[model samples]
Target: MNAFTRLRYRGSFMMRTLVSRSARLMRYCLLSLLGTLPLAVCAGEPVSPLLSPHQTIGTVNCASSTCHGSITPWEGSNVLQNEYTTWSRLDRHTRTYEVLNNAVSQRIVRNLGYKEPATEVKICLDCHAHNPTPARRGARFTQSEGIGCEGCHGPAADWIGEHAVKGITHSANIERGLYPTNQPIAQAKLCLSCHFGDESRFVTHRIMGAGHPRISFELKTFSALEPAHYRVDADYEQRKGSYDSVRLWAIGQALAARQQLDTLADPKRGHDGLMPELVLFDCYSCHHPMSDKRWTPRLGVGPGRMRLNDSNLLMLRAIVRAAYPDSSSAFDKAVRATHLAVSTGQTEGGAAPLQVVSKLSATIGAFLPRLEQQNFSPALQRKVLVALIDESAETSYADYAGAEQAYMAIVTVSNDLLSHGALKSTPALTDALARLLKTLRHDEQYDANVFRKQLSTLRSTVGVQERS
Candidate 1:
């Protein structure tokens, strides 16, 4: 029941069984969850199985030689029988548990006052291993496989066999215990749980201080880096609904902003007796010395203001402007109000930060289905690309956070355009993006001057105008 303790995996896991419908199983072979399940599942809406805690049946359950494991791929089949092989060998997630033993995680644990081994600490295990509650853990569950099958996909006890039953719908699978990673909003929330942190596993400033990696996430970028196992083909669209990178990026930014603000608003999340979680505030804003801190005045705010971590907010604005131009100004006002509240440390006023967060959350949530319905074809993609680039123009992206977001945004938009045939395969485009990407490779070492220069070069490659 440890959820990750190493299991003596069956030797038969490599048999070349010519399995039928294995293609669907391969497609289903996704590492898939959420603290905001209630937020995701409305009363009448279909509930995600992950909303309810389910017992983990372990990765070994699906690794039968005849099931997900095989030496090579099954030909002419939809399922790749070597899924387990791929995860265990090629996937870096398999090493999540082992990472805790590293000097860095150990030092973090020491700083966190955990006398026990980092592997056993709840803080470390929550994200590293599939650390489900004991009551929901089956006999097969162990803590050694890291984020094995059920880590993303919900506990499989109820869905294992029933999922294979004929006529069982994808929704039926979700109802049983499969986490619906296919849905854009749902996947955004689920991925953010660890990547951005949720109620159970939040990346607090304390953790960052204790040497956790700076959290940077964008849905399309991260998903591709995972090198997704399944293809987003016609069959995938039929099952998962639809796939849109631009839409995913937009929803992801909105959700991340919402999540960060929600965490900021939570009185319980405040630590070290700080009234508001200073963790919720921007790190570079306070961490840097006075000599290094030159503030930019924007949104009618005066100079010398210590800005909040509003990278996500800025991205969301561009996203909204691209999809619903009319609402962009209103959204901007709300965001500014919230930022002002945080900057001035004023909770009471017409622009109460929490109220602003709620309003924006609802507004962003309302925009999801509308975005989902729209097609992000070549023309739309081009517009979005420009809108996104415009958000980072001139000194607007002077901050490291904004610059980093813009860098990834540029890469994703340009890459997506290339894939969709919206962008011409020209050396100007490729080299510009590559140079911009290199500037972002190291946040600590990033030279803002170099970034600005490269960003200018990147903008010159396109029709994006410099906003005076």
Candidate 2:
């Protein structure tokens, strides 16, 4: 039976008390526990950012062909002026809004009995375009820009002019309304808004059944894969501090874990008709072979009402153990509590799982700031990578989605080690990376044992355990 249909956490009084608490208070308490907020308001709905008055100054303000629209690189300034050109020419995000008009998207919405076209759907626009409330809109806030500057940068009506002023600190710009992409924590919150989803909008189980694509996100990989416009050179670093993909990757997992838990706890996002949102759980459980016998005992602790999609949490635990050994025992305690609450709640039968998840969310929030503070040096990164492998040494990588994430993570860490000159670029490592990627290509036929064996050989070649 679906966990949602089973006993739900019946701590309504406690839940109401939490809801009655100030958003700021809840935010702070969670921050105190985990030390990070994936969104400004971690609980409840979507992020309600503080932004400029009505009238987004507009993307046109920076769209002049000679300014940010230049086809060729402009060398006259420390910041390149061809951002618009790069976005228009190479960025898929620029065309996000148009995607809604596609036949598939239209059909999906139509099947859902939404009379409006996909382009007009609020759920679609929330992510596909830079749709903002009139109070937050400036004169130039155009849906045409499709997740324009203001979408990720906050409404620019208040900040655009001062942003151009020479020597204006990035923090000053942030104060004026620039979303602090320079801050990894802020960036994760911002990116995960669309990359993952929040209470205000999410890709629900119904949508998935309606043919919507499955969402996958990793901050560092996606940032690089974004064919990034901004260069992380000395000038950029001086302004934004150092660039650390490993740190971003680790934090992204933590933030993603928090996002999942938040969704699970939020009733609005957790249910659909009589079923709990199946999309929130491990897709492989239902989507895979009916008689595969792969799921003899779900989660290594017997069956439950729901098998959650805990890929991010798995990585977060391994990372916490690897990167912060001093906190590993404490961290494990918290992680185990969450794991047990979620995995065994319905099997054990209770309406208390969400409450448990809520408390742990706060614990994770407290850990995030400290997690961000640690240096994910190449050496440390190698440790975390190995820890991820060792911790997942069980049949954890058996699920297609989990295995795919593991593949990308392995590729990311291996590349990081290579870039930092920590791991020698040899044929063995190269072949191992290639083979791991190949398994991802054939998820239907993927062999977990082969993937694991290859990963172990990779460990030998990379020498991650020898030192870290």
Candidate 3:
């Protein structure tokens, strides 16, 4: 049997096990978590699911055998009925809450000066689990379940009953509070809230210093890595409309760049006491040993000057230059001005950083709509791939973070090309990609020169000519 068939058989076995063991508890836990809190909207944009006022009905509500808990895909069904099974058995998200009980979490809690366990700490639970206020939690809402179905699908209290009904349309379900995860912009916002953070919950420098891993995200790459529960087949397309992988990557880059600027412009979050938040700067810049000597001028800043982490910004510039060349120079100018302002703010400590952040934010904001509507043709995909490789060859992707993002972008673009038949998979291309992966295998051991050389090999293998 193939992988899908094997998974179906295993899921059948697991379903039997669940039915035999916890059928009673499963029924009880499906109680609704919905309350009277109305969905909040600012201007026209709906509030993020994280900030939504709806009650989060427990995962059990959607895990019944006839609902989304079948052992295999249901005939004539619009969604894969084994969503819960796939998530519980294969997805790492189900184990996020459990991670808090481990030794590393204990050490992190201690380092953060929290006497309570990581499970009990609000900061730790905020991102690790689908934790809402007590008032908003349904009777079956258990934090132990980690990021349950309702976490991403929005609090199910309002729509759970009607969602599975035969006549209820997808749009109608969305109107009742189901989050539009299929939309790239909406997906970016929801994922970035936890990955990069927002006004509500941010992974600050203090948390990183306390042993939390550094945050990194590339939407399309990460989504693929999730091994999505639902297939994008014809049925799914008819219900949710079509999507483009390249557009997902572009929108993700734009939003991530905007979020960074938003953080920098916030009066409360921008700085720590007299110093700017250390987390905003490139970690490798200051963390490297004195003897390493990895420094070279970046953003026109001289040696020994701190540099803001500009991985997303650099990726955004590549996207604009390839797909929207008219805006390339203007966007580059804004980025440079922001860097200079940040550098000057180091000494001046006035309004310079915030001022530049505003300008940069506006520049990126203007592109968001265009990116959402732009169709990334196969030719444009090649242009983007070439731009990413050319920029890496020129800049060497000096920062480890930039190199990491670059690798993800290259894979995303290359995969898109192959899927669309614009590029063929050959042994030379496979070896080139493998070499790039090896170069980026470890952040501490990363060598920019080696990475740059691999980019050149990849460019040549893909038949991208050197830019004159």
TM-score of 2: 0.83
Worst 10 residues of 3 by lDDT: 32-41
Instruction: Summarize candidate 1's per-residue lDDT along 200-252 as a digit string, tens digits.
Output: 67777777666665566777666665545555655555554556666677778
Give candidate 1's whole-model lDDT. Answer: 0.66
lDDT of 3 by residue, 1-468 (tens): 553343344334433432222223222212211111111121245466666788887998888888878888888877889999888887778998999999879988998899999999988888888878888888988889989887788888989988877888767877777877777777888889888888888888887766676678889766765546877655665665566778888989999999998888888988889888888888777765578877766676778888889999889889999999988888887888788888655323455568778878888988887887787888999999989988875464888788878887887777777767677767887789778877765566568889999998998888842232
Query: Which parts of model 3 are misplaced by more than 4 Å?
Result: 1-43, 346-351, 464-468
For all predicted structures, in order, the TM-scores are 0.84, 0.83, 0.87
- Cα TM-score of candidate 3: 0.87
Among the numbered candidates, top TM-score falls to 3
Angstrom error of the Cα, residue 316, model 3: value is 0.4
Higher-lDDT candidate of 1 and 2: 2
Error of 3 at 297 (Å): 2.0
Once fitted onto the true fold, the runs of candidate 2 whose alpha carbons sit more than 4 angstroms away are 1-54, 134-141, 296-298, 346-351, 464-468
lDDT of 1 at 343: 70
Best by lDDT: 3
